[model samples]
Target: MSIRRLMPGRAALRYGLIGPGTHAQENLLPALSVLDGARLTAVAARRPDAAAEAARRWGADLWTDDWTDLVDGEGTAEIDALIVAGSPQLHADVVPRALARGISVFVEKPPAPDTATLEKLAVDERGAPEGTVAFVGFNFPYGQSYRKLRDTLRAHGTVRTVDLRMVSAKPTSPVWGCATVTDSLLQGLGTHAVDLVLRELGGPDRVTARRADIGTDRHALHVLLEYADGRLATLLLGNYSNRLEYRCELVTDQSVVGVLDDFNTLTLSRPSRTPGVGVLDGKETLRHTWPGRRGGYGRTGYSTELESFHRSVLHGEPSDSPLSACLEVYRVLDEVRRQTGDRP
Candidate 1:
C-alpha cells in the first residue's frame, strides 16, 4: 500500500522516539513523515539540545532527555508505540520497560548487549500485552534484490552453498565493523547475513569462524556455517576497505545467483541445455545480470519495514522482526563468538 493510503484518521498510530542519532535523523524521521498514518508525538534524546531540536523540527508535542518521560506515562503525547534507536547496549534496559508499559517498540539490531539479556527479553516479549509488537531492525531482507535472490533460489532447488562478502571503511561502516561488548562483527553487522541464511535455509547445524584484527577492530573475519543436510555457507567481512562493498552468492542444484552492493543488482547463472546434445549442460553455463530497484520500484526496505511495524500496532498484525526472531539472530551470533573465543 502507498503512504497516501494511510493518511489522517482517528486511528492514526502515534509514536514517541527515544533516540535522535544520524539514523533517526536521516532515515526514520523522513520515512515516518511519509507514513501519513503514523504521527510523531514525542522526542527524547541523551542531549537536551538534540531532543528539543528534533521536537521543533517534527512539531512533536513533547521533548525530553530522559526516555522515561516518554515510556513512564508522564509525557505529553498519548503514544501507541515507541521507537528505540539508541545504542545497542541500551536495548536490554529499554525494551523490557516499554513492553511492561504496554507500549510497542521498534529497536535496531543486536537487541541486547549479550545473550543473557536477550534471553530474558525473549520471554518478556512473549508475555507482553495482547497487541504489543517488538521488532528488530534487519532491513536487508526487506530489500528488492534480496527478495529476488530468495525467489530465484527456491526455483533452483535447495541452496547448496552461499558466499557472503562485505567490506567497508572505518567511522562510516554499519555498526563500525564490530561491537565492542558482544560478538563484534558476528552480531553487530554480520547478523544480517545470519538472518538472511536463516530465512532462506532454516537454522544452521554447525558454525565456526576466525577473526583478524588488522589495525581496525577485528577488521577481517571468515565464518563457516554448516546445515543439518550438509549444506555450507561462508561469510567474509572486513573494515579496512577503502570503500563500502557488499556481495552475496548462492548456489543450488539448478542455478547460481549473486546479489551485489546494497542489493541493487542480481547476477544469475544456470546450466545451458542444447537441443541435440547434453554436452554443454555441465560444461557451459548461461549467465544473466540485471539491476534491481532500491526505492523507485515500490516501497524501499526502510519504508516497508516501518509499514510492517505500523500495521502490527494499528491492525494487530504479526511482525517479522519479532523478539523471537531477534533472539534467534542473537543465538547465531552467540555461537559465532563462542567458537571464536570473543570476550563478553
Candidate 2:
C-alpha cells in the first residue's frame, strides 16, 4: 500500500530544529524551502542570539538557546517532529529526549559518538510507541544517480568487488557536529560510503584495516572488507586532497558500475565480444549511462530524503530502516578502529 494514503495531502509535518548551525542553515533549510511535506516550527542553537537570528531567517515561529524547551513543549509549537542537526553529544541527548516524548526524530549522521550511546538509543526506541519515526541522515545513496546505480547492481549477479574513494578539502571554518565524531573524518565522511557498501551487497564476514600518513593532520585510509561468500570491498579515503574527489565502484562477474565525480556521473561496463575470437573472446568496456543524476546539491536527494521522512511520519511508514542501517555504519566504523587501533 502506498503510505502517502495515510496522510492528509494538504497538511505539512511540523518539525522543530535543534542545533541550528551551518549545516541546518545551508543544507536542511534550503532543502526544506523547496519541499512541501515538512516545515520548520522552531530553531534552537547554543547561543540565544544565533538562534533568534536563525529563526528569523529560516521562518520558524520560535527560537531558544536551550533545546530542552522544544522537548518539554513549553511555550513552543506543538511539533510532530524534530531535525537534530547538532554535534554528536547534542544528538545523544536530544534525540532520546525527543523520542521518549513520542516526537519523531531526524538526526544527522554519527548518531552518537560511541557504540554505548547507540545501544542506549536502541533501548529508548524500543520503549517508544510503534510507528514513532527515528531517522538518521546518511544521505548519499539517496542521490538519484547512486540510487539507480545501486538498483542496477542488484541484477548483475553476486558482487565480486566494491571500491569507495573520497577525498575532501579541509574545512575553512568550524563544521557543526564535527567535534563529536569519535574519529571525525572517518566517522563523518566515511560513514556514507560504509553504509552504501554494506547496503548494496549485504554485510561483510571480516575486514582488515590499513592507513598511511599523507601530511600534517591529514591521512589516507585503506580498509578491506572480506565477505564469506568471497565478495570484497576496499574503502580508500583521504582528506589531504585539496580539491574534492568522490566515487564508488561496484563490480560483478558480468558488470562494472561506477558512481563518479561525486555522483555527477554513472558509467556502466559489461563484457563485449572481441572480433578476433579464437576462443579468447571478450572484454568489459564502458556501456551504459544511467540517467537520473541531478545537477546540484539541492537537487541531490537532500530534499527528497526530507520529504521521505515527513511522508513516512504522517503516513505511519517504517522509518526504522535508517535507524538499523545507521547502527551498522557505526559497527563498521567500530570494527575499523578495532582492526587499526586508531583511537581518535
Best by TM-score: 2
Candidate 2 segments whose C-alpha is farther than 4 A from its true place: 1-11, 75-77, 171-182, 274-295
Candidate 2, 107-176: lDDT as tens digits:
8886887777888887777777777888887677676667777676666666688888877765422343
- 144-254: candidate 1 lDDT, tens digit per residue: 567777775675667788888876664333352344522555565577778877776777888888877776343677888898787888888766678757787887755
The residue pairs found clashing in candidate 2 are none
lDDT of each: 0.73, 0.72
Off by over 4 Å in 1: 1-11, 171-183, 216-218, 274-300
C-alpha positional error of residue 271 in candidate 2 after TM-score superposition, expressed in Å? 2.2
